[model samples]
Target: MARMISYCMRIIEIPMLYLQKRLGISRLAWVFLLPNLLLFGLFAFLPVVLNFVYAMTGSDQILLQDRTFVGMGNYQTLTSCEDFLNPNSCKDDLFWRAVYNTFWFVLLQVGFMVGFALLTALMLNSKIRARGFFRSVFFFPVLLSPVVVALIWKWILQREGLANAALEGMGFDTINWLLDRHWAFFWSVFISVWAHMGFYTLILLAGLQAIPRDVYEAASMDAASPFRTFRRITLPLLMPTMIVVLVLSLIKSVQTFDEVYAFTGGGPGSATTLLIQYVYETGFAGTPRLFGLASAASILLAVVLVILTCLQLWASRRNVNG
Candidate 1:
C-alpha cells in the first residue's frame, strides 16, 4: 500500500510539473505576441476609432483647428439631402447611382468569382495532367498589381485595342467595350472577376486539400454518386472556407475603386461609379471640396460595411453549427 501511494504521488507530481512547464511556454508565447498586438491596435483599431469620431465632425480640417462636433447632424444631413441620397438629383445622380452600381457589382462579382473559383479548385484537386502548371497559370494574375491589371485590361478594351481588333478580325463589328455606359459596366465586372478569381481559387484549393481522403473513400464504398459525395461530404467540410471567401469577396467588391477608376473613370454617364470613387470625388475632385458631405457619405458607406460584416459573421456561425 505504501508503494502504491508513492507511485500515485509520482504520477501526480509529473503532471504538475508538466502544467508548470506549459504555463511558462504560454507566457513566452504571449510575450512574443505583444508587439504584434500593439501594432494592430495602433494601425487598425486606432484608424477605425478615429474614422468614427471624424464621421461626427463637420470638416476634415485638423481636429484641433476648424473641426466642430456635429453630433448626428452629419448623418441627418445625408438622409435629408435630395442631392446626396435621392435618385432624382441632377448636377449628378451620383450618390444613389453609386449605391445601385456598387450593389450590382457586388452581387454579380461575388457570385461568378466564388462559383468559378470553386470549379477551378475542384478540377485542380482531381487527377489532372500538369496540375502544377495549370495552378501556376491560373494564379499568375494574383501576383500582378491592381494598377497593372487595370491598365492592361484598359488598353485591351480600347477602340483600337486587342479586344476590338480580335472582334474586327472575326468579321464582327468593333463594339465600344469601355466607351458605352452599359458595356463599360459589363467589362468592369468581367475584368474584376478575372483579376480576383485566381486568389480565391487557390484559397478554395487549400481548403479542398485539407478535407480527409477517407471521407470521400467511405462515401465511394457506400456506392454514393459523385454528386452525392460532393453534396454530403465535400460541401459541409468546406463550409468554413466558403464563408471566408464569400465575406472577403463581398467586402472587396463593395470597396472597389482602382479598376473602376482606371477603366471607366466613373464616366460614360457614371455607370461604373462606386461608393469609394464617389467619396474621392466629393472630398478632393472639385476646387471647393465638400468635406462635410464627403465625410457623411463615407460614414454611411462604413455603416453599410459594418452591417454586412455582422450579417456574414452570424451566417457563418449558423453554418458551422448546422
Candidate 2:
C-alpha cells in the first residue's frame, strides 16, 4: 500500500515536473496553485454565491431548482413590522429577540471581557513570582475546545452542580443557574468571557511588552505616580492595540454560537439565543426549513461584519494619521 501510494504520488508529480521544465516559473506556480484555487472556488465562493441566490428566492424546498424567485420578499418579510423598537410587535419576533440578545451580549460581554483581560494582562506583564506559570494558567482555557469548555461550565452551573453544592455548603440558598432567564444569560456571558479572555489578555500583554522601558524610566525620573504613568504613557501608547482588540472582540461577540449553543442550547425559553443560533435553527433545525429567511439573516450578518471591518480600518487609519 505504501509503495502503491508512493507510485501514485510520483505519477501525479511527473506531469507537474514536466510542466515546470517546459513552462516558466510563473506558469508553473499557477500549476501548483490550481488545486487550492479550485477548492476555494468550490467551497467558499460557491457557497457565498449560492447563499445570495437562495436569499433572493422564497423556498420551503432545499434545492435551488425547486425554489421560487421572490426578488426582495424574504428581506421584506424580515423587515416587516409595526414597531421596530419593540421586538415583540415585529412580525418575526424571534429574529428581533435574537438581535436584542446579541446586542446586549456584545455590549456586556465585550465590556467585561476587555476590562478583565486588560487587568489580567497588566498583572501578567508586571514583575511577579511564577509569571510564566500564571501566564500559562490564564491562557490554558483558550486552548480548550469550545465544546469541552461549554460542557465543563455547564456541569458546574447545573442545578445540582458544583456551584449550587458550594452554595449549600456555605449555608446559602442554592440558586438555579441554568433554568432562570437572567441567570442563564448571566452565565452565558460570564462563561464566554472566561473562555476567551486569555486570548485578548495575551494580545494586550504583547502590546504592553512592546512599550519602551525608557518611557517608564523617564516617567519615574519625573516623579510620576504609577496611576499617572499608566494614564498618560501606557494607555495613550496602547490605544491602537486596544482598538484592534476591541474591534476583534466585538466581531467575535456578534458571531458567538458554539459555546453558547453547547452550554445553554439557547434555552430557558430562548433567553440566550443569539442571531447565529437563530439563523441555524431557522435554516436546519425545524421540520420546515426556512432557507431563504436564514440566508437573508446570514446576509444581514455579513453586512454587519463588513461594516465593522470598515470601521476598524477607518479607526486604524485615523490613528495612523493622528
Candidate 3:
C-alpha cells in the first residue's frame, strides 16, 4: 500500500513539473514582446497624446508659458475662423483655397499614381526578355530620397532646363514650366507621379507574383481570353494590394509638403500650396508664430487621414469577402 501511494504521488508531481515548464515558456515569450511594446508606447502613443493636448491650448506663441485651457474652442475656431492659426480672428480666403488645391492635388496624384503602377506591374509580370533589368529600372525611383527626386525634377523643369531645351531643339516654342500657375501645378503633379509610381509598382508586382500560375493556365484551358482572365481573376486577387497602394498614396499626396516646398515653395499665388504647407506657413512663417492654431490644423489633418484609412480598410475587407 505504501508502494502504491508513492507511485500516485509521482504521477501528480510529473504534471506539476510540466505545468511549470509551460508557464516558463509563456513568460519567455512575453519578455520578447515587452521591448517592442515599450518602444511603441514611448515613441508613437506619447507623441499623439501630446499633440492632442497641444491642440486644445494656445501653446504655439507661448511655448515656455503655461497654456490656457480652451476646451473645444480651438476646434470651434477652425470651423468658422478664417485664419487657420487664429480661431479668434476673422476668416482667411487663402486657407480655403489651399484646402481646395490640396483636394485637387490628392485626387490627381492618387489616380495617376495607382493607374500607372498597375500598368507597370502588369508589364513587368509578362514573360518578356530583360525582365529583371526593367524591373530594377522601374523601381529605382522609389529608392531615391523624396528631396533628391524633387531637386532633380526641379532642374529638369526649369525655364531653360533640359525639357524646355529639348522642346526648343525640336522647333517648338519654349514653354514656361514653373512660372505659370497652371504649368507649375502640372509639373508638380507629373514629378510626384514619376517619383512615386515605382514603389507602388513593386508592391503590385509582388502581389502578382504571389498569384499561382495554375489559375491562369486553367482559365486559358477553359477558353477564357486574356482580357477575361484578367478581369475576372487577376483583378479580384489584386484588390487588396490596390487598396493598400491607394490609401498610402492618398495620405502621402494629401500631406504633401516636402516635395512641394522644395520645388514650388507654395509659390505663384498659392497655386501649389498643400494643407500641410498652409499649417507650416500659419505657425512658423510670420513674426508671431501661432502654435495653438498650427496644432489644431495638424489634428485636423490627422483626423482626415484616420478617416480615409478606416474607409480603405473597410473596402479592402469587403473586397476580400466578395
Candidate 4:
C-alpha cells in the first residue's frame, strides 16, 4: 500500500513538473477545469449541435448517413398554412395546437405561481403559530418527485377519489376532472402551481429575510398601515427576486410535460398537450414517427427559451443600472 501510494504521487508530481516547467500553467488548474469542460462539451454542446443537424434533415432514420438533407424543408412545412394564426389550417395542426396550449399554460401558471408563492411566503415569514411546521408542510410537496405529485393529484381527481367524494357528500355532482377539456387544463395549471409554488416561496422568503427589520420598524413608527408598508418597502425591495421567479416560472411553464403527461396524457382531444409532449409523440411515440418535424419543433422551443433568457438578462441589467 505504501509503494502504491508513492507510485501515485510520482505520477501526479511528474505532471506537475511538466506543466510548471513547460506550459507555465499550474497542474492544479488543469486538474480542476479539464474534466468539467470535457463533460460540458460532450453532453451539452455536442447534443445541441446534433439536434440542429437533425432539424435540417428530412428522414425518420436516426442515423446521420441514412438522413436526407432537406435544408429548411422541415421548418417551412411547420410554418406552411393558409393562416398562421389558426392552427387547424396548418398541415401539422397538432404542433400548432400544442404551441397555443403552451402559451395559455405559461400565461396562467406564471401568474398563479408568483401570486400564490408570494402569499405563502408572507404567511410563513410571519409570527404565526407553528410557522416552522407550516413551512415544512408547504415545502414537502417540492421534495416529492414530479411524477409522484401528478399521480397523487390524478388519484384525488378520479371519480371515486377524495375530491369527488367531498363533492358527492356536499350534494354536488362528481365532475370528470381529467376527461374534460377546460377542467383538465385548469387542473394542469393548478397542480403545477401547487407542486412548484413551494420552491419559489422559499426564494421569496429568503429575499424577505434579507430585508433589514429596521425598515419595517421605521414604517411602523411612521404609523404606516400593513398595505402601505408592503407597497412602500417590501415590494420595492423584493422586485429582483420576483423577477427571477417570474422568468423561471415562464420557462418551466413552457417546458411543462412530465407531470401533466402522467396526469392527463394529453387526452380529452389534445386539451393539455404542450410543445414538449408534441415533440415526444412526434419523434418517438406515434406511427410514421416524424423525427425531422420533431427536431424542428425542438429547435423552435430552444430558440424561444434562449430569447426568454436573453430578455431576462437584459431586464436584470436594466433594473440594476436604473
lDDT on C-alpha atoms for all candidate structures: 0.84, 0.93, 0.83, 0.91
TM-score, cand. 3: 0.80
Report the poorest 10 consecutive residues by lDDT, candidate 3.
Answer: 84-93
lDDT of 3 by residue, 107-211 (tens): 999999999999999999999899999999988887888789889988988888999999999999998888899988988888889888998999899989988
Candidate 1 ranges beyond 4 A from true positions: 1-64, 67-73, 81-86, 89-92, 311-322
Which digits, one per residue and each the tens of the lDDT, describe model 2 over residues 65-118?
899999988888888879988887888888988989999999999999999999
Q: Which ten residues in a row have the lowest lDDT in candidate 2?
A: 313-322
In model 2, the number of clashes is 0
> What TM-score, over all chains together, does every model reach?
0.78, 0.89, 0.80, 0.92
Best-to-worst TM-score order = 4, 2, 3, 1
Judged by TM-score relative to the true structure, which candidate is superior, 3 or 4? 4
lDDT of 1 at 55: 64
lDDT of 2 at 30: 85
lDDT of 1 by residue, 129-205 (tens): 99999999889988887788889998898999999999999999998888798899988898899898999999999
